[model samples]
Target chain A: MARWEPNARERLVRAAIDLFAEQGYDATTVTGIAERAGLTKTTFFRHFPDKREVLFAGQELHSRTLAEAVAAAPAQATPLEAVAAALDALAATFTEDRRDFAARLLAVIAANDELRERAAFKHDQLAAAIAGALRERGTPGPAAGLAAELGVRAFDDAFARWSDPSVARTLTDLAREALDELRAALAALG
Target chain B: MARWEPNARERLVRAAIDLFAEQGYDATTVTGIAERAGLTKTTFFRHFPDKREVLFAGQELHSRTLAEAVAAAPAQATPLEAVAAALDALAATFTEDRRDFAARLLAVIAANDELRERAAFKHDQLAAAIAGALRERGTPGPAAGLAAELGVRAFDDAFARWSDPSVARTLTDLAREALDELRAALAALG
Candidate 1:
């Protein structure tokens, strides 16, 4: 159990994922998760409002990381560059240690429509936060929003590549590649 | 009611929007919409599966308009131009006659979380259709996806502007302005 000795929140999350993967999300109850983690239902409730919340607990942190990175970009950086830099910063957070966990979480989300909706909502929230950060840097409407969305799309593409088991590239590398492709694609559009 | 002497689907849609605006989406029922349209609940069911489907009835038509337009673009047209052409085709369908109805529909969607989710889902569906059409034209992944998304964003911004009561511009004109702004913003990324 030494490998499993973590905080209650982490323990509960691990147990929930395992149960969800084993018995399906709908069939896995909070009590089942708690019992598997050798904890109480009350502890599970303390950590997450519900089973679905566990899958999205990092949303706020993820949004802050991207927005703060965009906000902190050099004053001379163009809006697109600032957004690209923000994507790089966020990508760096998805280290080798997270690949397996991300795969599991993504698979769980893929298997559930309710979870997919929540994921889409979280993606929108993150994009809006990035757009707000761009606006703070004096980028105007539609422009800021469009640039932020492009950046998010790059991050999303990179995350998918990095989460693949056979892929050895870092998230930052994949994201930069995806951003370049996006730029080239836009350039080709003209 | 001669002004509303249209098909049952349109009547049901009009009834649903009016009821949603007056009593909120949660309080509006299929029976309420049918009664408001002076039609039977059976007619409403034949046109839409439920109350929620009324708000999203146009998604398939919107997606087809975009994809078909993209597919028919001149071979020499840039990916962006192809997408721009698609937007113009779609904008032409949203005549001045739709401005008031569109505004009321948007307001009802804005006032309801479920409706907003459905809208986002519809927007994504439309973007994917555009990307597929771009791919059929030999544009690659990530690039096709990004360009398609940018075009959709332009349409979205333009739609908002077009729907405003005080705005006098045509949807095509607003979309052109928004698309130009997007191009300039993308170019500034370098």
Candidate 2:
């Protein structure tokens, strides 16, 4: 039987990110990540399937968080309102302590084509999750999808801004502001 | 010196799609695709970087077509109007002759995770190209991005509908209708 490791996942992620940043993502290996975290390769495999997946650690949990929040919105709430609530829930997961890590993660992803592609897939998945939740709440197809897209765009834009060390606003506040900007921009599309 | 092969790209694409549909994507290989196409592996490499890229053959040309159309829209055209023109231009490339191919291509992509990720990346790239062109034409940041996303969504939805053998409408018409429906859905978002 394998011994239980404390915060093994978190430690592995930090180690992977540090290694990726130092030696470049392509040069980093699973064994190196495991060794850096003081864990066995088996422990690393238990948490992540590969080095690339380590960077996308919370994808499933984030998707669930967004969907559950959208599902829990008031029955009478508009699609956009539900999306707003979902963004709040997602943003809450990115507390102040993770801001620097978020910035570094963004830089690493931006530097690599495979990582960028994976990021785009994750973005689409998140939007789809929000859209599915809205549809379950009786929102029509197009509107559900559009509202979900807006929510994701807002969260993504706000995340980029929040990752900047100079930005003092909370992720939730930035997301709300970005969503409002997009809502206002819709009228100007004409 | 290598002998030139006529329609090598097209032949390779058709062969890949057929092979992927027959034996499944994972079971297929570049050498197998080249052999089925009656071309050499070197010729296949000349056209596509890998087997997966064979399915996304016209990606660069499609992006260029969309961006150029958006850039060439009338000076007074609204952002959405520019996107509509871009969609029409893009749809023209997918004539009736290509409908069956498009359907097969979509099915092959739908069955594979790696291909789906590539598709999402391509989708984002197309949207970004349109957004960049819109920005060049004086459209603001948020509105340009929102309009570009709507255009991509409309075209994607229209392509799916047009892929059905029973759908008689032209790709252009379906895209226009889809865009109009999304525009109307915007009003119901709140």
lDDT of each: 0.86, 0.93
On residues A33-83, what C-alpha lDDT tens digit does candidate 1 reach at each position? Answer: 999999888878878989888888878988999999999999999888898
Q: What lDDT tens digits, residue by residue, belong to model 2 across residues A23-106?
A: 999999999999999999999999899999999999999999999999999999888889999999999998899999988899
Best by TM-score: 2
The pairs that clash in candidate 1 are: none
Clashes of 1: 0
* lDDT of candidate 2 over B1-190, digit per residue (tens): 3446888889999999999999999999999999999998999999899999998888889899999999999999999999999999999988799999889999999999889999999999999999999999999999999999999999999999999989999999999999999998886764
* All candidates: DockQ: 0.44, 0.73
Q: What CA root-mean-square deviation does each model show from the true structure?
A: 3.7, 1.4
CA RMSD (A), model 2: 1.4
| Root-mean-square deviation of candidate 1 | 3.7
Best by lDDT: 2
- Scored by lDDT, model 1 comes in at 0.86
Give fnat, all candidates.
0.47, 0.76
